[model samples]
Target: MHTTALVLFSGGQDSTTCLAQALSKYERVETLGFDYGQRHHIEMDTRRVVLANLRERFPQWAPHMGEDHVLTLAALQQLGGSSLTDEVAFAMQADGLPNTFVPGRNLLFLTLAGALAYRRGLQVIVTGVCETDFSGYPDCRDDTMKAMQIALSLGLERRLLIETPLMWIDKADTWALAHSLGGQALVDLIIEDTHTCYLGDRVHRNAWGYGCGTCPACELRQRGWARYSARDANASSSP
Candidate 1:
């Protein structure tokens, strides 16, 4: 078991769940976020609020939560082509990948995270990347994660483990995992506080969370909520 962990937290639903899990399992867990010039800056904006709430709401995990690091990587905007790094409208490319696919976002995030984890003497790096029910981002694949873990350990000259708790789970299962980890309080915290809309639209709120309810992220989240709620309803009616 790893004693120390650094979560690649984005203040979104997935990352927040990962953070909660890290806090529960690790003796010490820190968070690392990147300012990659994303068009939707709400995720970055809400990081502090989420952390504060975690400390306030979950006393058990509060002692384990440690330092938070935010790195500014302006180079992403400089190398812009994707919708996230650019001012272009979101669309599907001829190659079938969404315009929101920032070419090297996850790869770059993991590399910087490895460097920071090495400096911080962290034993594990936790991330929210998922292969199932994701937008087909190749970087989120289990194979990609496995390869990155090997590469980071080799390059950093440290025995580092990359933990992807959400790797094989879809969004509904993700909600179920959160409920298992921290129960209804956590589920409520995630729905009310987490931000996942690509547009950073917090003006509109839904049963699942605050989002635009149309973007890929919002759609996935809403779909997951539907399934999760259905299961809950069925379970309640069980004999």
Candidate 2:
């Protein structure tokens, strides 16, 4: 039987890397993106662009890059506590979690992904939720993912492998993994095209995709790029 996988893609740097990894491993890979009424709704457009580029640049993987399914969760906007989904200003709490953290967003996304996977008879569901370097979102924790996996399995009555490729790795390691999967070209695609900014500002380009440069998401990405660049420079200079 051909192995099929569903990726919970957000069209961000980490999720894009997860997509690359999925394409490398699975025979058939379908992407699931959410239109959860985020302030950065531009991510949906970015996801489409990335998928198109993948098909155009790597025709060999085109067959594996199955459908890109986008689900609209407009209710998230109505709930309206998160800066990402609401008109509120983005701010980080004393604990480091920004207001951009949508409540139960990942949980809802994973549950929906589980339902899709169960109906499609897929055994694996890939996500880009990283514990390290993540902005204090409880849903992104490894423990949370494990618990969700158990709950999802019980709820669906089907065993599903929740793959978190970026769970343990930081953003810099994520960049290295993306490079290993498809080399510098993939890396460039992610840096230049993927949208990670909370502010949804794509006009200002930086080392790490377009962003306002002050949001937590952009800060983490920029720091990761700096670390990755330094490591690359050191490796090149070494005897």
lDDT (Cα, tens digit) per residue for candidate 1, span 44-106: 888888899999999999999999999998998898988887888878999999988987789
Put down candidate 2 lDDT per residue, 1-239, tens digits, no spaces: 43899999888999889999889889999989999888998998988888889888777678898877888898889888788887777788667778888888999999999998887777899999988888789999999999999999898888888999999988889999999998998999998879999889999988777999998889999999999999999999999
Local accuracy by lDDT, each model: 0.91, 0.89
Give the best candidate by TM-score: 1
Q: Give the clashing residue pairs of candidate 1, or none.
A: none
Using lDDT, give the best candidate's number: 1
- Global lDDT for candidate 1? 0.91
Evaluate candidate 2 by giving its C-alpha RMSD to the native, one decimal. 1.5
Q: What are the root-mean-square deviations of the candidates from the true structure over C-alphas?
A: 0.9, 1.5
Candidate 1, 11: how far from true, in Å? 0.5
